[model samples]
Target: MVLLFAALSATTQAQVTATIAQAGFGDLRPSDGFLVQHLQHGPVSIGELADKLGITAQGVSKTVIEMERKGYVTRTASSGDQRRRLVELTSRGWEAIYASRRARAEVNRQLRASLGPGAPAFLDQIHHLAEATGAVTLLTERRLRP
Candidate 1:
């Protein structure tokens, strides 16, 4: 249970880590803007995005509206399903995501360098353990909630 809790904590912390790192946006904060960038993961409906992120459809819709207002994401009706709206990231949103990812990579490299050596082995071991029990797949969905 301790490991499970730790994993959950780490996941939640990571969700906000990039936002804090990319602070100083005008309208949308780093976290919300970051989500906007990810909005281009194909034509996803509210329920699909909510299911993947463990949020309610209403919450995802609210966020989508905010992203649209910020010009980060655009909403379009699905051709086959008029009732379903899809979210797509704008070019500006892609820029934010690319820049944020680059920044994160730089920070990660610096931290790894400070670790001195054998970090790859350590990371490999962690990945091995993570894969052993489908830990990465346990991304916490509403279906899995109590």
Candidate 2:
């Protein structure tokens, strides 16, 4: 029974992960989308981005490197603090961010359409599950909560 439950749990997690991956824009991961969203407002230091995303500075650096290589972001020396580097999205990055938002919207539309009148309830349950599972940060959970 325990083994069967474990298998089921892994399968469910894989399905959820696949759904999220498919909902993202192009090859951008969720972390990339978060970085792009923050950069859309203004330039931010890698440390600050890491703080907001609750990730390690090294993780942010790796993602920034990938984003820079992809022409989605640029790392420049901060005028205010030469020791620190600021990350700003390029025009391509802005386009990618917008596309990500659209893709997420489309996913939501499809979910709602599929769920029909039960969509809200289904989303509420999902939100609760996410909170319980610590799938997102407390800050993100608060933002998603009513």
Model 1 over residues 10-113: C-alpha lDDT tens digits? Answer: 65446545554455334656447434533555667778777766678898899889878867778899999999988888776676667666656766676578
The residue-level lDDT of candidate 2 at 13 comes to 41
Backbone clashes in model 1, listed as residue pairs: none
* Candidates' RMSD to native: 5.0, 5.8
Identify the candidate with maximal lDDT: 2
Which lDDT value does model 1 have at 29?
60
Candidate 2, superposed: residue stretches over 4 Å from native: 1-25, 120-146
Runs off by more than 4 Å, candidate 1? 1-38, 138-146
In model 2, the clashing pairs are: none
